[model samples]
Target chain A: MNAAVTATRGATALDIAAIRRDFPILHQSVNGKPLVYLDNAASSQRPKSVIEAVSRYYEHDHANVHRGVHTLSQRATDAYEGARETIRRFINARDTKEIVFTRGTTEAVNLVAQSFARPGFQPGDEILISALEHHANIVPWQLLREQVGAVLKVIPISEQGEVDFVEFEKLIGPRTRLLALAHVSNALGTIVPVEKFIKVAKQHGVPVLLDGAQAIPHTPVDVQALGCDFYCFSSHKMLGPTGMGVLYGRKELLEAMPPWQGGGDMILSVSFEKTTFNQLPWKFEAGTPHIAGAIGLAAAIDYLETIGMERIAAYEHELLEYATDRLSRVPGLRIVGTAANKAAVVSFTLEGIHPHDIGTILDTEGVAIRTGHHCAMPVMEFFNIPATARASMSFYNTREEIDRLAAALEHTRKVLG
Target chain B: MDLKDLYRDVIVDHNRHPRNFGKLEPADVHADGHNPLCGDRLTMYANLEGEHIKDVKFEGSGCAISVASASLLTEAVKGKSKSEVKELFDDVHALLTQHDAAVDPARLGKLAALSGVREFPARVKCASLCWHTLNAALDRAAEPVSTE
Candidate 1:
C-alpha cells in the first residue's frame, strides 16, 4: 500500500505531445484526414511498451505456468505471479490470494454470480442493482435468478442519469443478499457514489460487488479504502491487451465459495473417485491462463504508474469540461447524461437526425465516435431515444481534437438535418 | 465519398414529408422490420386488389435513408403486381450491396436516389431494412424481419 501511494503521487506534469508519440495507432489518418479518436470508452489504444512486453514474453519466457521444473517454466511462472503482485500493489489489495484472473469483466461477474451468489441465494432472496448497469452486470444475475428462485430488483435513476439515493436506501431489506452496481455508467458517464453506497450496504450486512470496468481506466481504485466485497474490471479499457481481466474478492469469501469451473490447474489431485481443489486464486483459474496477457497488463500498470493516475484524472477532467462547453454550443444538439460529476464521456443527440447518420457524416471528416445504444439499452429506453452519438476522451486527447469534433458535428447537422 | 451522394435532395425531401406515411385500415398484408444495431424500426402495410398492390403505406421511426426508401418503395409499387414488386426488391438490394452491379436509371426512377448507399457499406443495412420488411409483407411471413 505504501508503494502504491508513492507511485500515485510521484509523477511530474504530463506532456501531452510527448505522450501521444507513445501510441503508434494515434499517428495514422482514417479517411484522408488525421484521425480524431474519441471512442476511448469502447477500448483505449495501447502504448508501444505494452505491445513490446507481450512480444518479449512470447519470444523469451513462453511456457505453461506452475507445472514444470524446467527453466522456461520457472521463468514463466515467475513472470505470471509477479504480475499478480503488481496488480495487488496497483489497487492496494492486502493479498495476492484474493486476485483471480478471468477472461474479462463479463466473465469475472459471471464467476461471482455462479460461484458465490447462487450457492447462498434463497427462493425469495433479492439481488439489487442499479438501472445504469451494462448488460454484463444485469444478465448474469438474471441467469442466476432463473436457476435459483431469487428475484432481481433495480434502483431507478433520475432524469439527469443519476441513481436515486433515497430510493436506493429504501430498496435495501433483510432479503437483499448482494448489491451489484457499476462504478461508472458506460452510456451516461455518471460516476456513482460508490463509497457511500458501500457504507450503506455494510450497515445492512449485505456484501457489495462493483463493476469497475469503466471506472478503472480513469480513476485510481483502492480496494481497501472502498471495502467492497468484490471488484471487477477489464484490462483492455486501461491500455492493456484484450482477453484479460481481474476479479478481487475478500479472502474468506473466495476460499469458502465453490470453484465455478473444474480442470487441471484448479485441482490438487485428480482420481476416478474424487479430487481435491488447489489453494486460493489457482482454484478459480481452471486452465493454462492468459500468460502473455497478464505480463502485458503488468507492463501497462507500470506505464500508468510512471504517468500517475492523479495527474491523468486531472488532465482528462479539463478535457471533458472543454468538450462539454464546446459541444453545448452546437445548434439543436442536446447533451444527455449531464450529471454534475462525470468522467470524460459526452453522449448527445441531434434533432431531426438519427445517430447513424451523425456517425456516418463524422467519419467522412475523420472523426471516430461511437453511435448506438452503447450496450446500455435500458439507458436508451429510459431516455426515450433510440440511440445516441458519444465522444469519450482519454488523457492523450487534446482540446484541439475536441474542436474538430465540434466542427464535424456542425457539418453533420447541415448534411443530415 | 461525398455526403451529398448519400443524402440526396430526393431522400431529404421524402424523409421530411414521407409519402403514404400512415397505417392502412383493412390492410391485406403487414409486417414489421427492426434494425437492432441502431434501433431503427418500421412497419409496412399494403392493401392489395387481386394480385396487384393497390395501396401501400408505412408507419414507424427511422433514419433518412430508411424512411425515404420506404416512401419511395410505396410510390413505386402502388400499381405493380406482386411479382413486379419482388423483382424491384431484388434490384434495389443488388444496387445497395453489389459494388459492380449496373443500375438502369430509367428503370429505377426515383429509387435511384439510393444508389449512393454503395459507397457506405455500414449504411447498407439501414437502406435495405424497409425493402426486406416489404418482402415479408408480400410473402405474408409471420415473424418480424430483423437486420441485426
Candidate 2:
C-alpha cells in the first residue's frame, strides 16, 4: 500500500496512500506509464472491498430476493434491503421507504418523469431545468415534454458557469410543474447552488429533483438538509457497481405516485380482474433487483463512511485547487468552467489543438481524460466549443496525477506543435 | 506504440493545410459525413466527369485524423474513376483498421500515411469518415453518412 507521491497535503486529508492502495486498479500501467484515472465523472474504478462484497454475495448468498423461503433468499433479501437502509441513512432520508432502487440515475429520472411528474403534468405545464444539466437530466424531461405537451424551460447560466439565480427566480412561475437540475454539472464541474434554487422552487410550490450523479461522490449529501423532493444518484459514480442507483423521493410523494414499472415483486397480489400494488419503494422496484449490486453498493458506502464524506470533500477541494492552478499554467490552455465552486473536475481546451487530439496525446501518456461534449451538448454549445478534455478527480487521486496531467499537456503541445 | 506512429509528420501537415478544403458548388455528387462520437462534421462534394472525379472538395471541422483523412482523400481520388476510388477506400480502410494490412506504396501513395491510424482503434472511424461519405456520394445518396 504505497502512498502515491503527492507534492502537497491538504490539512484535512485522508491518507491518500492508504486510499489508493484500497483500489488495486491504480497500480496498473497504461502505455508504460502509471495509470492516472481522471474519468471518475464518467465511471470510477471499484475498490477491492466493494469487488469482494459482490463476489462474496454471489459465492455464498446467491438467491432471488423477497421470494424464496430458503436461507440464501432470506440472506440475499436482508442484504439487499439492508443496503437500502444504509443508503437512506447515508443521504439522511427520513425512511427506507423513500429510497427506491433504480437501475441508475437515468432510470431514476425516467421513473420520476413517468411515475411522479407524468401523472400530474398538464399540457403546457413547464418543467424547469438549468442549462448545466447532463443529458440524463435534460433528455428525460424533453421526452416528457414531447409526450404531455409540457413546456421545458432552461435556467440560464453565466459565463463563469454559475446558475443565474435571478433568472431562476423569474422562471419559477405557477405553470412550472417541476424543477430538475444537476447538483453539479458533469461537463463543466459547476456546482449549482441547488439549495437556493430549491428554496425558490418550494416557495413556488414546485417540487425539485437534484441530479446527484456528480455531487454524491465528491460531497456530503443530506436529502433532508437539501429539502429537495427527489434526489437521484448513480452507484457507479460513487464507487459502487454500475446499473445500481438510488432515488430518494419524499415519503408522501412516493406513497401518492403510481409505480413506473409493474411486475413480480411490485405487486401485492394479482388476478385476472385486478392486482393491488406493493407499498412505497418495492412498488417502483418491478423485478428481482440487482441483488449483488446492492450489496456491493453497501460495501462502497461503508468504505466511503470509513473515509468520511466531509474529509473526502475537503481533501478533494484542495486537489481541485491544485489541479486548477497547475493546469492553468500550461500555455494556450483555457479552463472552460471557471465557477468559484466546482467539484474536482477540470474541463479545459488547448488553443490550437482539438480536445480529441489532446485526449489522444494524453492517452499516450496514460493520463485518461474525458473528451468531447461529455453528454452535455448544450453546455458545449453555450461555451462555443465543440469539446473539451475533462480531467475529473476522486478521493484516491493525487497531486502527482495532476502534475502528470499538466506535464502531458506540455508534451501534447510539443507533439502537436 | 509511439505517438509518432499515430501523428506522423505527413498526417500533421495535411491537417494543418488541408487541400481542397472548401465547398465545390453545383457538384454532381455531394454528401455529408458525421462522426457523432467526437462531433466531427464533414461535408464532401465531388464533381464527376463521366464517373471520373473532375474535382473534389470538403468543408467542415474535426480532429486532426479526420481533417487529414479528408484532405488525403481529395488528393488521391481526382484522376481515379469511382470504381477505382471505391477500391482505394477498401485499401485505405484496411490500412487504417487492420494492424497487419500490407501497404502497396505505389497505389496508396501519400494516403499510406493514414496507416498510422491502425495503432489507434478508437480513431479508425475518424480516418475513414471521408471515405464513407465519398462512397455515399458515389452512390448519389443524399443522406449524411455517419461513422457511429
Candidate 3:
C-alpha cells in the first residue's frame, strides 16, 4: 500500500498508527509488497514489549521456576507465578489457583476431558458440543467417548453460522454431563451467545466449558460473570508467544478432578510406594511449564490493558464493518458468516475460485489470510462449502490493509475466474 | 513469482473445463484422494484393459491448480500402459516440485503446464493429489490417499 493509503485511519478511539508501530512484524514487506496480515485468528503478531519481555527474562532471570533456593530460581518463580496472576486478573478469575497454564487451548481442553470428564462421566452419558467448535474442543470429547462410553452429541448451527440455541435446549437432557462450546467461531467469527446456553446448562445440572481461544483477543471474558465451569484460551491468539494458554476451572471442580498428567512439577512428594500431588493449578501442569511464554503473555496482557479491551472491541467491530462493505463490492465475492454480533473476521468465497487458489494469489500480493476448513470440518459440512478465505483482523489492522486485500482479491478473481 | 507462472492459459482453460470429469461406473480400479488441509477431494476411476488404462475419470471438488492438474493427468494417462503412466508420473512429480528438473516436451507434452506449481510450495500437494490417487488405483489399494 502507498503511504497515503496507509495513513488513512478510521474514526476510532485508539491511535491505529501508534498501535501498528508497537508490533514490529507489521512493518515488514512480503512478496515485495507491504504485508497485510489478516491471519490474526490463527495467531496474532506480538508487540515489541512482549518480544522484549521474553528476551529480558531469558537474559537476566533464566532458571527452572518453583524449585531451587538459587536467586535466579526464586526470581523465575516469582515472574512465572506473577504472570499467572496477570492472566487471572485479565480474565477476572476470582483466584490465581483457578488458572492452570497449559501448552495451549488443545491441552487445556484435553485436561478437562481426561481429568474431569473421563473419570466422572458414566456410561451412556452425553458430552454435548456445538457445531462451531474447533478440533481442539471436539476431539478431546471424542477421545473421552471412546474411553468411557460417553456419547458425543453435537448442537447444530444454522446456515448463517450462529449456534442453534433451540436445538441446544433439546440436546441438554438428564444424561448430558457437559456442554462445551466455542465463544467465538475461529472459521466464521460467529460470536456465540454462550450466556444463554450456560444458563440452560446450569438449570439442567450440567457444566459448561467455553473455548475462548478466538474470543479472548476480540472480547472481554469474565469466567465468573459468564458462569462457565471451565474457560480455555491460548496466549498466542492474544499477541503472545505460543506453547502457553490458561485453563480457568472452578476451584471446587478442579479439587475433585484427578490430575491429568503427573510429572516433577505436579508432585508434592514421590516415593516407590506412593506419590502425593501438588496443590491447585500445579497439580494439572505436569513437567516444566513454558516460563518464558507465560512472561511474554503477561506483557501482552499489559499492552492490551493500556489500550483497553472494550475500546479495542469497538475499533475492531468498525474495521469488520469496513472490510465487509469493501469486500462485498468485489465481483463474485460472498461473505460466509454474517452473524448480528461478530468479531473482526470475514470468511468469504469468490465465485468460480477455490479458497486455496485465493490464498496463494493473495500471498503473492502480500495478504495473509487463513484458507481452509480452519480445523472446523463440521462447520464446513454445515455450510456445504469446501473451504473459505478468512480475513481476520486485529486492533492494529486498518482499513487501508483491508482495501489492499480487496484489491488483491479482485486480482485473484481475474486470474482464477 | 508471477500469477501467469501458476495460472497459465492452458491451466486456466483446463480448470474452466476439466477433461474426463465425473464418475465412471464399473471402474476396474478406483481410489479417492483427500487433501485434508484444503478439503480438496477427488476419486480417480480407471477401467483397466490388461495393464493399459482403457478409460479414466474423476469426481470431486478442489482448487484450480488441483482440478487442472487432474484434468491434464486424465488426458495424458489415457490408453497408456502402467509402466508408461509410472514414467509420466515421475516426470510430472519432478515438474511440480523440483524447480530445476529438465522437461522433455516430447514425453511430458501438455503436462508441462503443471511446472508452474513448483513456484508455489503449498500448492504442490494440490497438483500431486491426483497422481497419488491414480497410483493407489494402480496398486489396488483399499484406503483413500490423504495429503495431510
* DockQ class, candidate 2: medium
| Colliding residue pairs in candidate 2 | A3-A17
**Candidates 1 and 3: which is better by lDDT?**
3
Kindly list the per-residue Cα lDDT of model 1 for residues A192-255, writing each as its tens digit: 9999999999999999999999999998999999999999999999999999999999999999
Best by lDDT: 3
Q: Order of all candidates by TM-score, from best down to worst?
A: 2, 3, 1
Q: Rate residue A347 of model 2 by lDDT.
A: 94
lDDT of 3 by residue, A294-392 (tens): 999999999999999988898898889999999999999999988989989999989999999999999999999999999999888888998999999
DockQ of candidate 2 compared with the true complex: 0.71
Prediction 1 TM-score vs. true: 0.95
Predicted structure 3: lDDT: 0.91
For model 3, the superposed segments whose C-alpha errors exceed 4 Å read A1-12, B141-148
**Model 3, residue A105: C-alpha shift (Å):** 0.6
Go through the candidates in order and give each one's DockQ: 0.76, 0.71, 0.82
lDDT of 2 by residue, A109-219 (tens): 999999998888889899999888899998998899888899999989999999999999998898998999999999999998888889989899999999999999989
- For the candidates in turn, chain A alone yields TM-scores of 0.97, 0.98, 0.98
Ranking by lDDT: 3, 1, 2
